[model samples]
Target chain A: MSVAGSDFAVRVEGLEKSFGHWPVLWDLDLTLDWGQLLVLFGANAVGKTTLLRILSTQARPDAGTLSVAGYDPVRTPNAVRRRIGVVGHQTCLYDDLTCRENLVYYGRLFGLTDIPRRVDEAISRVSLGHRADQRVRTLSNGMQKRASIARAILHRPPLLLLDEPEAGLDQESTVMLQGLLKEWAESGGAAIMTTHNVDLGLAWGETGKIGVLADGKVQVQEPGRYANVAEFRQVLSSSLVTRQRN
Target chain B: MVLVWKDILLEVRSRELVISVLVFGLLVAVVFNFALDVTPQRVTAIAPGILWVAFAFAATMAMSRAFVREREQGGLEGLLLSPVSRDAIFLGKALTNLLFMLLVEMVLLPVFAVLFGFSAMSFTLIGTIVLATLGFSLVGTLFSAIAAQTRSREIMLPVLFFPVILPVIIGAVEASTRAIGGETTVGLGRWLPLLAVFDALFLVICPWVFSFVVEE
Candidate 1:
C-alpha cells in the first residue's frame, strides 16, 4: 500500500531533542515516503508529539538533520509549513469564531482562493454543516474534532501531522478519520500520527506502517509488519518490557 | 492581511476583548472621577495622567486577551503551522491589539472628557495616544506571547509587561499633559520624540522576539 519513489516526504536522522535537562527523542530516525501513513505508537510523554512537532516545523531538534517536503525545517520553515498540516490534542480552533469562520481564517492564511466556497465544502465534507455556524467552543468534542479535520484538510497539504486525532472522536468519527487518512494517502500525501490506542492506529490499513517508540527511541518499525492487531500487541508488549528493563 | 483580518473578525464576533476593556477603561475613569473632585483647571492638570493610566490598564486587558485566546485554543500553533511567516503573525497580532486599544482609547477619551469636564480633543493628544499605544501594544504583544508559555500567565504578563513599558507611560503622560494643557508644540517636541523612539525600537525588536519565542 506504500507509494513508490525513494524520495521521502519526511526524513529525520539521529534526531535528538530535550526539554531542559531531560532528553526526549534520543537519536531517533524516521522516514516517510510519498503517500504513506506512519502511525507512531508510543506511551504518553515518550516524545511522539515532540517528533511530530519537529517534523511539522513547529520545533527544532537539538541534534539532527530534519527535512520535510524537501526543505529543512530549521532553514526553511515557511516552505516546510506550506507543505504540512497539524492537528494536535487541541483542535486549534478559535473558541470565539464559528466553524466556518475558523476555516475562513485558515483558508485566508493559506491564501486559498475562493475561501467561502472551500470552507463550505470542508465543513460539509466533515459533516459539520449543521454546526457550521456554531462557535467552536460550543461544539461537542466529536464535532470539534471534525472541525479540526476540516481545518487540516482545508489546504490539502502534502504532509499531515496528527497528535491524537482520535482522542475525542466517536466510532463514526473514527471511521470518517480513517477514510480521510485513506483519501489523503491515495492522493500522494504522507501523514505521521501519534496515538496511544494501538488498535486504532494499527487499523489504518494493511498497506500502512507502524512504529513503536520506546525508551526515547523507535525500537521497532517496519512497513506492514503487523498482519493483525494480535501481532502488533505482542510486539508492543515486548517493546514495553524491553523499555522497562532498560 | 489574513492574520490581521482573523483577529479583527474574532474580536468583532465575540466583542470580548474590546468591550471588556472599554468598560474597564470607562470604569477606571468613573472611579477616578468619584475619588477626586476637581475643577476644570485641575482636570486638565491631572486628567492626562489619569487618562493614560486608564488606557494603560485597559490595554493590558486587551493584550492579555489576545495572547490568551491564542494559547487557550492552540491558535498560535495553528498559526505557526500555516505557511505565513512568523513576522507576519507578529505584525498581525500587534496591529490587532493596537487597533483594539486605540478603539478603547477613542471611546474612553470622549467619556473621559464628559466625566472630567475637560477637553482633550486635540490632534496632538490623539497622535500621542497613537504613538504611545503603538509602543505599549508592541511590547505587550511580545511579553504576552512569552508569558502565555508560563504557567501563571496572568501574573507573568503584568510582571514582565509594566516595567518594560514604563518609558512609554511616562512619555505618553508627559505628551498628553502638554497637549491637554494647550502647549502642544512644546510638549510634543519634547515627549513625542521619546514615545516615537520607543515605538520605533519595539516595532523592530518585538517582531523578532516574537518570532523567536513562538518557535521556542
Candidate 2:
C-alpha cells in the first residue's frame, strides 16, 4: 500500500504485462519491504514468472510503475539491477565452467576485488566446496541449483528475486538455502520467491506474505496472516475456485 | 574488459570455437584446391574469393557458438541482470567474436599460401583482413544475439547474418585480391575505404541495436 516509501524494496502499482494480444498480468499491484520473504503461489500460466521478470528488470511491463529498491525497472534498469539478485528457474551457470569459475565470474560482474576468497566463501556457503572445481554440466541438478544460489548472493544484493529457487534442490540443499535466506531476511534484506509447491511456499518466513495469483490477478493476498501451512492451503484452494469462476 | 576477458577465457578453456573454426576453414580451403585445380598463374584470381568464403563460414560458426553459449546455459539473463551497461556487453562480445575470427584467419592465411602457392604475408592484406573482420563480427554478434532468442537460432543466425555482411565480404575480397596481386597502393584506394566505412558504421550502430535487442 505504501510502496513509494523508502521502507519498501519492491513496489508495483497498476502493473500490466502481456505477450502480443495475450495478457498475462492485468492491473496487478503488490508491495514488499525489507526484512521479509514473500512466497507467491500460483497455478501454471498464471503470470508469476512474467511478474518476476518484470520485477527483475529482464522484461518490461506493458504498462505499470514497477520499481525495485526505489528505482524504476523500465527507465532505471541499471540502478535497479545493481540492487537486486535474481535466481530464476534457470541455473544461469555456464555448463563448461566449473562451479568456482562461475561464482568468480559473477563476483567480477559485481566488482568484487578479492574474487578468489569470495568465491571460496560462496562455494562453502552452498556446501559445494567439495565440487568447486567440477564443471556445472557434470554436477547434479541439485548442485547446480546450489551454484545458482551462490552466484546470486555473491554480491549480497538488497533485494532477491527468486523464481522457483527450490525446484531442483534436494532436502539437504533446500534446508541450507532456507537457512541462508532466513539469515538474509533477518539482516534486513528482502526476497520474493514464486513456487508451485504450496507446502514449501507457505512454510517460508512466518511473518511474511502469502499471495495466490490466479487468472492474471492476485486472487488472494493475506499479508501478515496465514502463519501456518494448513490454514494457507485451505484458503488457497477455495480462492482458486472462486477466482476462476469470477 | 571483464566481459571480453570472460568470453575469451571461456573459449580458451572450452576450445570449442577456435578448434572447430580452424578445422572448418582448413577443410574449405582443401575443398577449393581439388575443386578449382588452379595453376600458379591463376592463384591471385581465385584465392581471395576462396579465402573470404572460408573466413565467412568459420566466422559464422564462431558467432553462433558465442551467442548460443549464454542462452543455452541461461547466462544471458544473468548478464542482463547485472549492473553493467548493455553497450559494454555488446562491445565485449563483438571484440571476442572479432578475436576468434582473426585467430582463425591468422592460421588459415599461411596454410592457404602453402596450398595455393602464393606468398600471403603483406601489411595491406593484414589491414584489409582486420577491417573486414571487425565489420563482420559486429554484425554477426548483433544478429547472433537476435537469433539466440528465437526457436530456430542456428538457422536464424546465418539468415540474419549473411545478407547483411555481403558488402563486407565483397570489399574484403576485392582488397585482398589486389594485395595478393602485389598492388598494395591500389588495393587501399576504394575497397579499403568501403571496409573502413562499413566498420565505422557498425561500430556505432551494432552497440545501439544490441542494447535495444537485449532490453526487450
- Write model 2 residue lDDT over A153-184, tens digit each, in one string: 88778888899888988999988978887887
* lDDT tens readout by residue for model 1, A1-246: 222332788888998999998888888877878888888777667778888888888888899898787789999888777778788888889988899889988998888898888888888878998999999989999999999989998987778889888899999999888988888888888888877775687687344777888767775465356696577577765543324423
Clashes by residue pair, model 2:
none
Our tally of clashes for model 1 stands at 0
lDDT of 1 at B27: 84
Candidate 2 on B1-216: residue-level lDDT in tens?
777777877887889889988999999998988899888989999999999999998988889888878887788888888888888899988998888899889999999989997788898899999999999899999999988889888899889889999999999989888888985466459988999999999999889878889986
Best-fitting candidate, measured by TM-score? 2
Best prediction by DockQ: 1
Ten-residue stretch with the least lDDT total in model 1 chain B: B179-188
Whole-model lDDT for model 1 versus the true structure?
0.83
Instruction: Return the lDDT, model 1, position A120.
Output: 88
How is the predicted docking of candidate 1 categorized under the CAPRI scheme? medium
- CA error at residue B86 for candidate 1, angstroms: 1.1
Per-candidate clashes, comma-separated: 0, 0
